[model samples]
Every structure is written in structure tokens, then in C-alpha cells.
Target: MLTPSLMHHLSIIPDFRQAWKIKHQLSDILFLTVRAVICGAEGWEEIEDFGHEKLGFLRQYGDFESGVPSHDTLARVMALINAKQLQTAFADWMKACHDATDGAIVAIDGKTLRGSYCRGKDKAAIHMVSAFSTANGVVMGQIKTDEKSNEITAIPELLKLLDLYGCLVTIDAMGCQKKIAHQIRRQGADYLLSVKDNQPKLADAFEAAFPMKVIANYAGDAYTTVEKNRGREESRYHVVSDVSHEFQGLICEWPDLKTVGAVVSFRQEGDEPPDEAVVRYYISFAELTAEQMAKAVRQHWHVENKLHWFLDVAMREDACRIRRGRAAENLGRVHHIALNYLKGETRFKGGIRRKQKKAALSEEYLADVLAV
Candidate 1:
């Protein structure tokens, strides 16, 4: 059964439509859009079509006294709605659905909606930074920026909206800023940030601390894993250490710094020479063993593989062209909401694409997904 609190959560999003001219309720339109997107609707027209076809199903959750609105109405309302307000409500709804556990890994990353850009109007594509709960497989929160370069500033804002106490946060090299690290620490959560030439001095220090000669003989705590599939073989080597004593100069610049780690990856494909090995370094505020570090680092890609990949491949996020005002940003939030719903629905034994097809074909299964 759909709970009243769920409807109440959706109702709290501030409606920007004029009160005297309002025809459809804000929650009704939002609820319809979320359900439509979950069932494979890609644009305003498809969403309106879904609403017309599933008006009875939607009426079960929200009042549609005037019936489903037109496609233009849906687009206009979405374009005018406050994206930040909708995002906060979406995050709150996610939190209500799943309570994050302490020590859970929260991966933060950014992706651009390539199709949102408009060359005719000189509008840039929309870039969004999202916080995904690795353990829960749900997006905790997201913030939009004008471009990829703005993620450094937008990440801290995204972090402030989430409940991060006791969680371990991980970000890629682009988010490996001192201010971001401090922000994560201040939120009562630990951080594991990838190191690259973005911070040349820090990267040099980490590389110097884990020299190849030292890695060859002085192994304190090490973990290695190998995998083979489709005639391709890859191996990852992770070594972690307490570097406060040796890298004191570098440690002083970071907040709550505890450990330094390195991951070396080697790969070979079918009928090809072995690829050059790649080495990545990370600094963490948590005291983790090599095994834990390896697991956390590997799990961080869940944002890309699970969230971003699913958005682009299954949901066709990069193909969307909703570039007017805040429509694109708001639609991205709707996608996240639908994605979380589908992810939490584990009764069906298939991937997201299969489940989305099932929802489109059967309203009964769609109800089952929304019930969660």
C-alpha cells in the first residue's frame, strides 16, 4: 500500500504555478512524471501519453479530478518548478525509504546531460553531482551546475543536503579538493579522495611514499585480486599504510588525515600486448586495511556503473532534450526517483532494463514497484 507520508512528502515541494490559474496539483504532476519515467516514458509527450493511459492507476495514488494534463502543461510546470526544492524533497523521500547505516560508503560523482545543451541558444549542457549510497543502491542527493568544472563548488553544496554522519565518502580526482575533504570531515563522515596531477605536490608525495622498490619488498598490508572474462584478464593490487610519520608535510595540509593508499591495476586483452599498468593513489580520513581500501575504491564506481550508466543506457538520460529553464534539472531528479524505486524492487529477478519493460507491459508490476 502506498503510505500517506509518501504522498505528503511529494506535496511539500513548493509549487511555482500561479494559484489562480493552477489546474493540476503539483504532487499529481510530479507523481505522474515519476511513474511514467519508470515505465519508459522519455519526453513530455510520452509522459502525457502514459498519464492518459494510466490515469486509473495514477488515480489510486493522487487525485486527478481534471484528468491528466497536456504535454505542454507538464513541460511548463516542470520548467518553472524550483529544481533545488524538488531535489531536497527527493532526497528526504529517499532517506525515509532507507535508513543509511554507519560506515556505509557514499560515492559522489558528476555526469553531464549531453542532450540538454542547445547550440541555437548558446545554452550549455547541464552537469549534476550526485551522492549515491553504495550499500543501499539509491541516490541520496544531487545538485546541478552549469558545467563539469563547477562540480568542485557544487559538491560541497550537495554534501550539505545529505545525512552523512559516520559514513565514508569517496570521490574521483576532480572532487579531490582540500575544501571538499574538509567539508566531508566536518559532516562527521570520513573521506577517500583519489589523487592525481590536479594536486601535483600531493600526488608526488603519495608516489614518493609508495615507491616501486618499497612496494616490492616492504609490504605491510597488501591485497590483490584478479578476474578473467571474455578472454580478458585484469589484476588489481592494493597497498595501504599509516603515513602520518613519513608524509607529515603532506598530511598537515589535509584535515583529519589518517591513511595513504595505492592501487596498481594491470590488464591484458585477447590477442593484444599487455596494457601499460596504471597506478592510482588515495588519501583517506579513515583507518582502513588494504582489503577494506580495495573494496571501498572498487565500490566507488557504483555511481558510474550503476547510477550514471543506468541513467544513460536504460533511461536514455543523455538523449533527453528538456533544456528549457529548470525542466532538465527537474526531470533528472524524477529519473533518480524512478531509478531508486526500480532498484528497491527486488521481487523481480532481472536487470533494470528488463524491469522497466515489465512495468511498461503490465500495470500490476508497476504498482508492485511503486509500493516499495
Candidate 2:
């Protein structure tokens, strides 16, 4: 994984001549935004301030032009730089991060930046669809929506840009469309999607097909699993049972949904287990035993804990208000880049903002972090 510290060791610029000749080389743009991210910059002006203040150190680092690119220069270059090109380069970075694991769980999710909106715009939101690798702790790439379009369209475009072979792609209810399922399968990947109201017919059918009553009485494929943890006083017991296709209604319309499964889990804390248990239904491509399927389902949450939750709560991404021109899209990419760096760091566990603050305070760490 391209940890912030380790990535600092790599070269950020590949074409020196091209980098030098450009109005603003890619490295200056990349490093500048990285520095701003490290320093808690939320807008182009803040980034400009950061760059002007750190000119000496930045010049020594050797990625900028004659001096640092002015705030206007930075804004213009970012506006002109094709979002697709930057996205491609970002994908390369993500590939490096995912290379550590033979096959990682890459979650595709969307976030709407509520603060990024023009004064009179109709939707008043910028939708960003991103792919995050749980195994490597890196974000693959992100694309922006001009209006309030469905993720169905955005997810496919994002998927088409990525290499999905050997990795399991996880999507929420919004991404449970048939085309997406087919797309994942076509890309040599397996999908584990949540059953919900978005695909109401299919979800209802799957539920009816694998009802609790059917599971309670039937003698079918069954597995019992247990998990124990001491630090948080967590204990879990799961019973995974599968049902045949006999009771399936609309589930039959879904491609390759052979077995309908249910996992009933009970958790305990403090001194006793909770009286109310949690039951989850899953549709799987892999014919995993109930135990294995349960594990994969649980691991899927890492995307929320490791990616979205971190970006929103730790990085304060949704709270940002950089909505002019391509600033919304450009800054979103910067957030992912910083997130990739932080996710790679093994030493920090406090949160992204704090870790970034520490990096800004220590020149050695800052240089060590953004070197590459």
C-alpha cells in the first residue's frame, strides 16, 4: 500500500521536461493540494496561503515551478486539467495500493457534497461516486455528476474505468440493479449486494423466499458460528441457514440467485447478550458456507468504517463548500488522495484531521509524507 510515509519515498513526477514546461506541472498541482490537505485547507485561497507560506520548503522539495504556483494559477490549472486524466493517474496510485493484496474488497459508493452548490442551481449538490479498496486501504478513483443523476449510471462508468477481476465489489441498495449485477459478473468479479427497497420487488421476493418461518422449520443447509472479543466486550453467535428456490417470487427474475440465505446474529455486551437479535439477508455469488458468507458480509462494513465514515467525520469532506467551476470535483479528488495516504499510514489511528495536523507541524514528517 502507498502509505503516506512510503509514498513520500516515490517520485511524484514522471516526465521532468513536461512537468517543467507546463504552465503548472502536475506535481506542483498535486503536491500543493496535498500540502493544503495536510494543513487543513478547505478552499483555493487557503491552499494559496499555505503554498505562499511554505514556498521555501516546497522549492527545496523540488516539485514546484520557479516558485509556488499562485492561487490563481493553481485554480486555473485545476480547472483546465481534465478530470478524466487526473482520475486515471489516481487509479494508477490506487492500483499500487491494491497490489499488496492478491484480491481486495473494493467498495463502490457515492456521496453527495451538500455544501458544494452554486447559489441558484436547481439541485444544489455535487454527486461523487468513488471506489475504495478495503484490503489495501486506498481509494481507486472518483467521478462527479453534473446533476442529481442515479448511481446506476455513475457506478457503471466508474466500474468501466477500473480493473475489477478477482476482487469482490460491494454496493448498497442503490446499486442493486440487474445491469450492475451483470456488469460485475462480466468483469470477472463477484457481488454481495444488500437487499433493500431500491429493488423492492426482488428484495420482497428474496425475503418471502427465505422467510423466518421457512428457515425455522426446514432441515436444510445450516451452519453455526461464534465470534468473541475482549476489548469492547463483544460476543456474537450466528446461525446461517439457506432455503431452496421453491418459494422464490421475483427473486427468479434476478440472474443467478440460486440460494436464498438468512443469518441470525445475537450479540452480548457488559454482562449479558442483548434480548433483541439482528437478522440479515444476503444474496451471494459465491457458494460460501453460511460461516464464510457471514464473514464476507461483516467485512463489507469496512468500506463504511474505513472510507466514507472517515471522509465525512474525520476529514470533514461533506462540510466543505468549494463549489465554483471544477473546484468541487478537483477538491474531492484531493480528499481521496489524502485519504489514500492516511489509510496507508500504520502509526496513526486517531483520525485523518489530527494525523494531517501532525504532518503539517513536523517538516520531516511532511516531507516524508508527500515526497512521492
Candidate 3:
């Protein structure tokens, strides 16, 4: 089964000697935390209750915490746990789960912990930025914002904690900054960023300057498809050729630019199709090829469809309101860990939450998920 011992056996937790002196061993802590999450524990009190109620099973994983640590103790330890260490350990676990999966697209995006607003009624909500590996469907690293800061300030720090070599990193308009582009290039990875009104001049320039005339005539290998469902429809056309000249403006502005182009997603719904095509623009740092473009473009939604959607629907994270003394940040990590476990399951094809409940009731489900 995916027991605490499995995490102990496979995790990249540090071997510091003082770890043994803690009130609870590392394995027990991880086990209880994982189990508590699996059993629907939302905050510190829920985790404590789950651990206390399952003391016997927890003992099977390792020696018991002298008494289930109080909710505050759990929160204190979680806050004190080095985020970098936990990030490294999470990365190692993902490596074991994602062996031999090359050309995997690892999308990095920031999520705000909506419930983390702590300084009473007047204070701004605490925001945390995270880099999620859309390939393995796991969160690679996360960093919280300092006072008087935003995600733009924290994204670089989070990126530094991850090894992005050989991965295609995708980010939205919030990450369209030139400095962030340079950082991604410096790390030896490619990028596909959505360009929007935030960079008005750049967006206007690209939209006005694309090779519409030449592109229509010189079709080397074009791919087009239309998906119609429910009350909406999406039509996508990918035209890939030499985009180097097209990227000259961006290159002058951001030196990391190798190639760039526009990606247009036209959507229509109800009875009437819109007169003007709704187009979204994109810029890429990767080599332009028809096949490569299609693969990367389609896979980019794994960030939204797989990670964000799961968090909102399956984990019900949006309903959470646990904003007290590290509970918010720590619980978010716990949810990330649980989501990773669920995503790694090979046997289930249904919803993640249902699979989680099945895993809770069935040891085999847990075993397959935790198995290396």
C-alpha cells in the first residue's frame, strides 16, 4: 500500500541527524499528513483528529508521535519545514514516478491562496506562487510573497528552486515579463507565453506585424481542427514556418527570443457565430515546427484542465477558509501532495476524488499510487 513507509523509502528527505529528535519521526509526520489529507482533513484540527483516531494504523507506519501533536504544533512544524527541502523531496518523488517520460511539458504557473488573508479585515490576502509540472501533474516548487509584493516578484525565486532543463515551460500573461523570459532561457528551457493587453505595445505590434500574406500562400504543413460540444465550439489552425523575422521586435526587446508567432483560438456559441473571430496571441522561445507547436500547444492545458480544475472541483480547495498561522500555506502543500498521488494512479480512469475515496477504502489503490 501507499503507506508512510513508502514515502520514507522513496522520498528525498534530508538525512540530518536532528530530524530523529523531533517529537515525531519524519515518516510518521508524512504518513499522518498524507492519511489525514486522504481522509478529507482540511486544516490542522482535522489532521490532528484524523491522526489521533487512526493511531493504531499510524503506529504500523512508525513510532507514534508521543501524543498526536496539537493542531498548533503541526502548524508550527509545517511552517518551520524548509520549503526548499520539501520542494527537492517532492521533485525526487516525481522523478521516480515519471521515469523515461521525455519531451514532457512542465508548465509553471502561480496560484493565490485565497484563504490566506491573515491580518484581519483590512489586510491584503496572502498570495503564494507555485511552479507546477504539468507533465507529471505535480507541483515542483512554491514560494510565498513577501509583504508588499506580488507573483511577479516571487516567480523567479520559485523557478530558481526547480531544474527546468529539457522541459517546455508555459505561463500566462502574468509571466509575460522580459526578465522572467530571460530567467527561463538562462535555465536552458523553452517558453510559450500568452501575450495580452498587459504589454499593449508588444501585443499590438505582433498582431499588426504577423506574416498573414506570406503564411496563407506558403503552407508547408498545416493542421486544422474544430471541436464542437455543448453550446460552444473552438476552431484552431496551427501554421508553423520560419518565424524568426516575425520575432525581431520581441528579440530587440527581450534578447532570449528565438522564434515567435500568433496562436488564434476562435470560439463561438449559441445560435449565432460572432462576426469577428476571437483571437488569442502567443509568443514562443522554442524552434517553430508544425508538429512541435501542436504538441506543446495542446499539452499546455494540462496546467488548467488537470491541476487547477482538480483543485477546484475534486479537492474543493476554493471552498476552504482556513487562514490561521501557517495553516493556509501548509494545507495547500498537503493538497498538492495528495493531488500528485491521485494523478500518478494508473488504474483509474474516473474522477480523482472518487479514486481518492476508493484508495482510502482499498489498499491496492493506495499501493499502485505509492508504488515505485
Candidate that would win on TM-score: 1
> What's the lDDT for candidate 2?
0.68
How well is each residue in 1-372 modelled by candidate 1, as lDDT tens digits? 243555667777787767999889988898889889999999999999999999998898889999999999999999998887888877777667777788999999998989998999988988899999999688999989745458889998899888899999999999999999988988999999999999998888877788877776655999999989999998898999887455788766899788898888989998788799888999999999999999999999989889999999999999998988899999999899889889989989999989998999899999899887
- Model 1 scores worst on lDDT over the 10 consecutive residues at 1-10
Query: Where in model 3 is the C-alpha error above 4 Å?
Result: 1-27, 65-67, 70-72, 79-89, 92-102, 118-121, 211-221, 244-246, 249-253
Cα lDDT tens digits for candidate 2, 195-261: 6777667566656666667666646656666666772233333334344544355444555654456
* Residue 21 C-alpha lDDT in model 1: 90
lDDT, candidates in the order shown: 0.88, 0.68, 0.68
Please give, for residues 1-372, the per-residue lDDT of candidate 3 as tens digits. 244434743355553437556676655666678767765676678789877776776675567859677787677666565555665566555444443244557776666666566566554565666667665667765677876877787878877867778677887788888888889889877888878899886677666655566444645656566778998887776665445454555566764565555555677887786445545566777775755676677777777788878877787777777665555666676788787777767577867888777866665565566552
lDDT of prediction 3: 0.68
Q: Among all windows of ten consecutive residues in candidate 3, which has the lowest summed lDDT?
A: 94-103
Better of 1 and 3 by lDDT: 1
Clashes of each: 0, 1, 0
